[model samples]
Target: MQDRTILRTPLCDMLGCELPVLLAGMGGVARWELAAAVAQAGGFAMLGMVREDPALIEAEVTALRAATDRRFAVNLIPAATDPLLLDAQIGRCLDLGVDTFTFFWDVIPAVVRRIKQAGGLVLHQVGSAGAARMAEEAGADVLIAQGVEAGGHVHGRSGAFALAETLLAEAGVPVVVSGGISTGRGLAAALAAGAQGVQCGTAFLATAESFAHDYHKARVVAARGEETVLTDVFVLNWPMGAAVRVIGNSVTQGLGNRLLGHDPARLPREVIAEDGGTALMRFSTDSPMRHTTGNLEAMALYAGQGVGAIRDIVPAAQRLHLMADEAAACLARAAGSRA
Candidate 1:
């Protein structure tokens, strides 16, 4: 194998990680087990605790700390979550001594200030250059440029590489590219384009350690890039105009004509699924987790455009190592081409 050092970027030094791969803090799917596995493998990990109760956050953080001493981040969506809950979540993370926090959806300056005031590093995921600028002004330590091809809740309409290029042009801090990146070649491409790192969702979600259900993992493995669709059909728990990229399912397929412009209030309150006694209504933004039970096929099966590249479910550590090795090779080949 080529030297792993070739895959290291300045992001590794800033985040105190060995590789530039960052596990996407995917809500419901990215939990303690997956984060720990990635961190233990020398890549940065993130716990997806968006809008979760503080007790659960404590538990997940405790579990991750127990598994590994490596650095990891907690992801929270300030705009999507209630203000009071967001405060509590941030407070809980700070109390737990977490030094890194990642936010998505909207750039809340006050939240960023609060984290920064507490000496926590902030990584904001932005879909547009305007948002990226706003995040930087809000004191974000790093920026994650998410494109339309990203899975789950997408923020920017621009393609991944285009957004990264735009952000890297003026971003004072490191820029990590997200959306539709699931391979070592993708990582190499991001690095070649001057991105400091890559945030991956679909690739990591399909791993054996992910909290995603087996059915969801199977769908991602069997899916094609074109099989994924971006629609506002699943917007129950989030604000209006919030779009998500998910595998084509019966619910989405049924929206033959009306694929967008869905008003969550107008949607019928039909419980399509449940997790731990919580009723998951139809059109809910919640994805299928390991404990979720119901019409799994009709629920939101989130997957990026890169889902087609994923063929098997392996351990998170194994996946990270493979990607690192492949990226090292790809980088070496690019260097040779220039030589």
Candidate 2:
């Protein structure tokens, strides 16, 4: 096996991780179990706590801490979450001594400032060069350049590589590229393009440790890259114009002409599923989690363009090691080609 240490970058030192890989802080899907497994495997793990209550955040953080002592982050979406709830979430994270945070969607300067004031490290995920600059100025320690190929609540129109190239040139902070990056070849490509690291959601989400429902994981394993669709059909909880990339399902297919320019508020709030006794409505951004039941196919089955690469559901640690080993081999091959 290739020495995986050869694949490490400066980002590894900064994040206290052995691999320059980050599990995308996918809300609901990336919970304590997945995060702990990834962290134990030497990849940076992020607990996806988007719009979740502080109590849940505290409980998840507690579990994560109990599982692993390695550095991890709590992912939050300030723009999408209620201000009071977001505040409480941040507070809970800080109280738990979690110093690293990953913020996605719109970059809220005030929220960034608050984290920075508390001496926390902020990794802001942005879709455009403009947002990159904003996040950098707002005191981000690292910037994650998210591309349109990313699953769930995409913000930028440009592809991953193109946006990454632009951000690498413009941002002072270290940049990590996200979207459609599943395999080691993809990781090697991003590193060759000067990205410090790669953030992956779809790949990790398909793992056995992921909190996503088994049905959702199976769909990702069976899906082709083109089988995924980028649409706003599931915007019940998020703001209007918030686009997401999800595996095509009856909900998205049934949209037909109503794919765009329809008011989500006007749509019927039909309960399609249930998560721990809470109703999961149709058109809601909530993806099917492990505990969720009823009409799983109709819920948002989020997946990246890299879904085609995921053929099986393995443990998160196994998946992370495979990615690292592959990246090392790919880098060696590239270097040998140049020689």
Candidate 3:
């Protein structure tokens, strides 16, 4: 990788990281090990706690603190959580000395105020310019312009590049482009497009430290750009009616072109593996978590369009370093070409 200095941007300064890359805090995928690895690698790592138990969240935060002193952030989905549960989790984080947070779905004014009053930074994830303005008005310190190609429950209507450009023009805060970014060129492209940094989920899901099953990782590696589709069929229990990007699997194949139909309850719930089994919940966005058994291929394999760029499951730190180097090289080559 080029000198870490070469890849530094305003986002790096604000987040106190060495590089302008962020590992997306994907609820089940971006766990303690993966977040710590990326943070340790000089890039900002974010832990996803949208569906996490309060105790689990506390334990994970303690574990990451034990692993690295570098700055990291946590993600919360307001729509998916009850007010009491959300407050408990956030309180636990604050008590543990965590200050950086990212909010998905909708911005919670109370939560934002709590974090800020405690001297924390808040990042609000938005899918459009209007949402960006709303988030900025809500006092978000940073903005994550999420695009349509993002994995999990994507709420954006435009592509990442276009959304980033739009958000930069209207939102008076540093913008981090999310969705469909995986390679060094992707990082360079986001920077060139006027973004402070890029937040990547699919790329990190393929990392060695990720908690996704090995079979799921392999599926991500072998997937093509076109193999992914957006659908709301998986939201059996937590049906927000939002379309999620996922690689084609038995479940998706059965759903076909319809975005919403058929009851998820009719589908198989118990996955019997070689050892213990796991139950697939309706309306739950949990990816095949680590140690998940039984018909794993039938579960939601959440991934972005960048799945095509993933070929191997390397350590999170190694992947971040390589991406930084490749982005620096790409920008250098582009500059030379223009000259």
Highest lDDT against the true fold, candidate: 1
Question: Which stretches in model 1 have alpha-carbon errors above 4 Å?
Answer: none
Taking all chains together, the TM-score of candidate 1 against the true structure is: 0.99
lDDT winner between candidates 1 and 2: 1
Error of 2 at 21 (Å): 0.5
TM-score of the candidate numbered 2? 0.98
Q: Residue by residue across 1-339, what tens digits does model 3's lDDT show? A: 475575678888899998999888888788899999999988998998876778999989989989999999999887778778888888888988888999887666777788888999998888888778777877899999999989878887799889999888887789999999889989999988889999999999998999888988999999998899888777754545667899988767775577565455554464334323446553346567778766677667899998898899999888888889999998888878999
Model 1: residue 81 alpha-carbon error in angstroms: 0.5
**Please, what is the whole-model Cα lDDT of each candidate in the order they appear?**
0.94, 0.92, 0.83
The lDDT-based order of candidates, best leading, equals 1, 2, 3
* Per-model RMSD to reference: 0.7, 0.9, 2.3
Among all candidates shown, the one with the greatest TM-score: 1
Cα displacement (angstroms), candidate 1, residue 236, comes to 0.4
Q: Which portions of model 2 show Cα errors greater than 4 Å? A: none
TM-score of each: 0.99, 0.98, 0.93
The digit string of per-residue lDDT tens for model 2 on 258-301 reads: 66655787878999899898999998999999989999999889
* C-alpha-based local distance difference test score of model 1: 0.94
TM-score ranking of the models: 1, 2, 3
Clashing pairs in 3: 235-283, 236-282, 236-283, 237-282, 237-283, 238-283, 272-294, 273-294
Worst 10 residues of 2 by lDDT: 256-265
